[model samples]
Target: MKKLLNYFFQGLLVVIPISVTIVVIYKIIFWIDGLLPFQLPVKLPGIGEVNIPGLGILTIVVGITIFGYFAKFFVANPFFLLLERLLERTPLLKIIYTSVKDLIEAFVGEKKRFNQPVLVTVNKESQVQRIGFITKNDLTEIGISNQKLAVYLPFSYGFNGQLVIVPSENVEKINASGTEMMKFVISGGVTEVD
Candidate 1:
């Protein structure tokens, strides 16, 4: 009974992730297809009049590609800059826009702040250590850049993390990819890498 139950659960663990992924993708595609404003009766210019169920998803793809291309090529730089300026002028919009922009840039932009994984000595005297990523090397903005650095320590078994400002002397940069570090931390140290 124990062996059979173990095998059953092992199979379930393998199948559940794949099943959930497929279901979620299917639902998202369905939702996007359902966003069609109206059925095309006659032929249109770019796309001919066809009641294609997946056309909404296709349109979304095309729109996002065009926007990304424009943004990448700086074709929409002036417009975006103007919009940012306008938002910065407003107190509420400034906070919201800047926070969103900074978070996105930190994760996805050229300067990926979380890529620099390191081993931090939390308490130098007792040698309490922790693994984290260097978030900020330059603390000049906060007026403490002499020997201080900001590190983000991700929690085990959770998505949340804590950011701590520690002295640069206490941090030892590690030679590990961000994804590897994240996976190890998320798995609660179950996963190992040589």
Candidate 2:
């Protein structure tokens, strides 16, 4: 009976999060579609107000396609360039646009490379070691060179931690992938790879 209860609880843990995530995504898409100027009037035979199946996804696809088309052509065009310059001059909108553009570029840009994970000693004793990801190597004109590493110290069932930057020499490269490290972190070091 105890074993069955444990399994049921574990199942609920997985299923609840998945269902919640799907519902949240659906609601967001529905809200965005509501804001659009036009929408398909044809409703499904069974579902009265749900519109067509996967219409939200279709709307997103169409919106992205239109945006891409406009960006490719209009961005370089003289008239559009003038409008863009005018918009950029606006203080409030410019700040918002610049911040959003930077965030988007960071996520989707080809030049962006993520920190590589390595093993580092955490506490006073070298015996206590933790996993860290190398952010970058900073070469300053002050004749001081330093390597930045982000260490994720996991706590509880989820990651509620800070990223610590340590020197390069303090860390040792582990022959493990990011996925394996994530699993280890999520399970609070209970999950180990042979």
Candidate 3:
């Protein structure tokens, strides 16, 4: 009975993650598909008009890509800049807008902030350390010491994190990709760092 239980536990370890991942993806695709508002059927070679699943997701992706391309080198760029300026002028909206924009830009913008993963020395006496990303390398403009750097230490199993000011010497650069390190940290170190 113990041997059988061991096998069952091992099986669960393999099956649960895959099952949950598949179900989540399936649900997300259907949710995005439902957001299309109107479904246009396409006629295939042999089959009659058929409504394709996930067409909305495809359309949204293509539309966003096209918009991004145009906005990069067209009149829309100035229009967006003006809109952004107007949003910045508003009191409460400015804070929320800028924060959200900065958060998104930090991850996917041209100047990616989380690319540099570092190991910060939390307790030098106990030789304890914590993993974090260097967000701001320079602090002179902010009146902080140049030797001190801004580090964002993400919490395990959550999207929130705390920012700390650490001495440059106390932070050691880790040789790994940001995405993998983020996954490793978010998974509470349970996921492999490959």
Q: Quick one: best TM-score, which candidate?
A: 3
TM-score of 1: 0.73
Q: By the lDDT metric, which is better: model 2 or model 3?
A: 3
Q: Which candidate is the best by lDDT?
A: 3
For TM-score, candidate 1 versus 3, the one ahead is 3
Ranking by lDDT: 3, 1, 2
Clash list (residue pairs), candidate 3: none
Candidate 1 achieves a global lDDT of 0.85
- Could you estimate the TM-score for every candidate? 0.73, 0.55, 0.83
Question: Per-residue lDDT tens digits of candidate 2, residues 1-194?
Answer: 99999999999999997999999888877887786677766765786755553575687888899998888777788987887787688999899877676546533654332335577777656578876555445535435455544455545466455556666667787787755765776677787765
**Which residue pairs show backbone clashes in model 2?**
none
* Per-residue lDDT of model 1, residues 116-167, tens digit only: 8899999989999988999888898879876899999999989889999999
Whole-model lDDT per candidate: 0.85, 0.67, 0.92
Residue-level lDDT of model 3, residues 3-24, one tens digit each, is: 9999999999999999999998
What local lDDT score does residue 188 receive in model 3, on the 0 to 100 scale?
96
- By TM-score rank, best first, the candidates go 3, 1, 2
